[model samples]
Target chain A: MSEPILSIRHMVKRFGGLVAVNDVSLDINPGEVVALLGDNGAGKSTLIKCVSGVHLPDEGEIRFEGRPVSFPKPIDARSAGIETIYQDLALANNLDVPANIFLGREAKNRYLGGLVKTLNDKWMLGQAEQSLAALDIRFPSLTQPIESLSGGQRQAVAIARAIYWKARLMIMDEPTNNLGVPEQQKVLELIRRLRDQGVPVILITHTMPDVFAVADRIIVMHRGRKVTEKRTGETNASELVQYMVGALDDTRTSA
Target chain B: MTDSKAMAGFDEPALSAGKRAILLISRLWAWVFLALMIVFFVVAVGVFSSATFLSVRNSQNILVAIVPVLLLGLGQTFVIIAAGIDLSVGWVMSLASVLSAHAIRAAFNAGVPLFLSVVLGFVAGVGGAALVGLVNGLIIAKLKVPAFIVTLGTSFIVRGMSLLFSENTTVIGLPEGIRDYGNESLFYWVRGEGGGFYILDKPEVSGELLRSMDRILAWPVVITAVVVLVCLFLLKRTQFGRHTYAIGGNMQAALRTGIPVDRHIIKLYMLSASTAGVAGVLSTLRFTAGSAVIGDPLLLSSIAAVIIGGVSLFGGAGSIIGTVIGALIIAVLTTGLVMLNVPAFWQFIVVGAVVIIAVLIDQSRDLILGRRGRGT
Candidate 1:
């Protein structure tokens, strides 16, 4: 991989003396899908939070674009071209899909010599229509609020927000956990499409189908440590489970 | 985009922006109810008593009496919109009156320029009230305490301060200019049309009013109207206004959207107190005498008018015009009862019942509308 897009080195985190993530490290390369796989208490979410700047690692270094960086807040992380699409999808239900897309960063027009500013509704709606189309998200009306949309459609808007911002790295936590078969396939297709467009994604999930369907590399964690790392093409789902349970390591594999 | 469609509901483009300019004004219906009540009271007075039931002088007197209370209601709207209540309004009024009275008397007795003491009194009253408001905001925002408890505590504190300073006494003397600011006619370009007849009494602002209508509007009423309009514009049009609604609606949702939630809420609390100070100043100037007990009775009515105006007790919903109408409804009801010679004790009962009924209606509308949305 040509100079990792995002690199983590010995990342550690604790919550009231409970070592949630103890000295873990991973690298996400440009145009590559890295799967951070773990079971319930494997510290996958904690590591993702550290990378997304939601929590400051207790002891570790996070390098973005090959330079060591520290972000005090999530907005700082976003401004640095790192965006996280959370599982809950924090889109305002009362607002339309377009409105949800350009919510905080609203386009404004200065009508009276910059003394007065107004929401540029026409411009934002047009852009929302385009972004929704580019993502292949079909909604009945461009003006319908997100609450009126199906679960898949709502997820589409959240993904569209991540993509439209043009983030260099996107981290999705459990992107397909609640999705049915068709929706899961749709999301998988969307992930491959995102990779083809040159944005690296960190998919955090325990579903082997999701891992096999998209990941270029799989990193398994148990307790608070990274136990096994392998290229996805060379690995099998059953063997990955052994590493997750600490019955196997990266060095040894048993049938 | 057409006028009827725009008025019927909020269409895409607002056509009423220029010609009619009415958005969020469904609140004005209550004000119409207030006007009707006034007319009914006038009729009742004419039929039952020998005293002239209605005349230009009595009509204007009723308006003047209601003006200060309306100011208080307008100020309270800001606080309520921020999901807060200001129970300190009555105390704030008393403080303003005492401070202004003392300042006027001291400066007048101490042989200083008359205007200087009046200004000093205003500054003292408004400034003290604002300081307490700031404290209220700081406490509520920083400690994350509920607003109702904090304001309630502060109300007793300020009330105690007012009593201690006044010693339950009344300050009698006040400057002419300060008093006239609230009471004076200022101008009456025409007296009246020499009447050809005097029959059944009704507000005859036709030629009779037209003959005397050339005068500039009273400054107090003008001031109150200006404050209401500015507040309406700010709450309905500005970014801060939108933030206020968002915070009141759901603080967590607002914060996630990157709105500076705590600061905005605190500023809202302070704004409420500051406007209460303005009303207090107006009240002090109107009454002339600085009674230690000034505006004690206004608390319940001021709040009643605000809630009745269609301002949601649940917060996140309400309008300025609604508050004005609510205030007017309360005002007209009180005045109408007195004009019809209803006994003082029955007047409170009547007003209290009206307040309760209005609040119940407002509460039910909110309950229905809230369940309609997807739990915003």
Candidate 2:
């Protein structure tokens, strides 16, 4: 009933002659997880890329918090309170957890009337500890580089980064792809926590059970086109598979 | 609650005390290597020769020998940590040396003040090398040329430019004050004419007034120390340093975080060239002349020091202190070999072997840490 946090209308993104995302439109409301389901190369990634500022849409508009917005770079979208955690995790593996948490925007202590500035590492480490703890995530050592952490812990760090930055909308691309079973469950739990915090999440995933378990709405895309949109309770995995494979289409018109 | 336990299960157990000790030792392996080398040299020199290698004079000699390589390694540390290399650094230093020598000579001939002429020479030297670094950065960052290729090509070009600029000869005829400034000591312990030891600010060079004087710290060493301290601060305490590691660690991640990757790369190369410039000027000051080929043999030594210091060639992890130890290792090996009357050719063979050993140790440490990191 309330206004959607992000609205995409008639979005189109093309790579050369290939239309990767074709006239796809979706709305994400606050406190809800929208599972963007699709097969490999099925425009789901491209659609989210448009909103996340990875690719500019060739057609259509994106509105965030009721204002028409265009992000020229990923940083712009981030500054606008939309954080995208790429499938690769977007972490500097050589750096510690706190450094990853405050990658670009680091806290600093300035001396000599701001002439000399050093990273306020103590402050950042404390804040990172609090944020991770808030999400019930614990690390044996916060100073260990991200590469030493397990896959699930890296995901927690990424999610904590989004939360620390106060992102209103979280976009995760295949967050559970390379994770183990337990790690996958941890990530899904984190998604639920994001939703509970009133941050809308657009989850691009291929896992059916993940969609069923956490997503409130499911939008299935096939061949760069949206096939169906359904409430999680309304659609079973079999029905979603039919829509995903283009066997069922709610938007297609019979010729 | 169950998920939290699952997460805990995924983490590798806290390192055992023995393993933690190994980790600490491995992390400080470069320093340990340096200390071990000094002990070996002291014992070897004492047993095989009449001189003591551990004396203050020999230590000063080692530190002085470390200056050029350490300066170059300091810059290489940044580049290597950023997953880049600057082959042009040696030649860039040569070019700066020639330029500064010429500028100083010309300024002195033009009746410029001694202090201003020295400053002018420094500006000319650092500015010239920095320009080369800028070009190197732009081509590598913007045109996407590989850093190794770009620096190699620039190295050849700068080598030719230095020879051309200096007319294929060492520039000489520097003012007398320049040599004095270069050799001056911060403190001098003098056996004075009154049969008493006195600490003087300036060494009384006259034979009548001074029996023997021990120079506590020379200007070159002081200058090098100041440069080291500043670089230490820059690399450890600043955002620029954090971004340098991030860029090297995962450049894509750095870009996604909105870091100015290209700009930072450009600055990094410039910083590297600037250090080389400093080394060049110091060499000119030490010798009171600048030769186009002075930095020629130092290229490999500087890189050897960097790798020996535990800086991963793959980038994203290294420290300035490690590079300093690495430099000391090289300097000590060279000086100790000479003290033992070893054939000069053996120095190269031994250093080359040490480099291989250092890299092997580094790789093994990574394997150990990496295996543990995977929670296996």
* Candidate 1 global lDDT: 0.72
Writing each residue's lDDT as its tens digit, candidate 1 over B174-225 gives 7666776665454444354543322222224575565544323455666677
Q: List, for all models, the DockQ compared with the true complex.
A: 0.16, 0.45
Q: What's the TM for model 1?
A: 0.74
Q: lDDT by residue for model 2 over B201-250, one digit each (tens)? A: 57446666553565667777888899899889989999999999998888
lDDT of 1 by residue, A165-241 (tens): 77899898888887777667767767776788889989999899999998999999988888888999888999999
True contacts kept of each: 0.08, 0.47
Candidate 2: Cα lDDT at A176:
90
Instruction: Locate the minimum summed-lDDT window of 10 residues in model 1 chain A.
Output: A144-153
Q: How does residue A31 of candidate 2 score in lDDT? A: 99
Instruction: Give candidate 1 regions above 4 Å deviation.
Output: A31-39, A85-166, A172-220, A227-255, B1-66, B104-121, B167-169, B185-217, B336-376
TM-score of each: 0.74, 0.95
Residue pairs with clashing backbones, model 1: none
- The most accurate candidate by TM-score is 2
A1-255: candidate 2 lDDT, tens digit per residue: 999999999989999999998888889999999999999988998888788877889999999999999987777898999999987788888899999999978899999999999999999999998998887787789998777677788888999999999999999988898778877887888888788889989999989989997899999999999888999999899999998888898887542
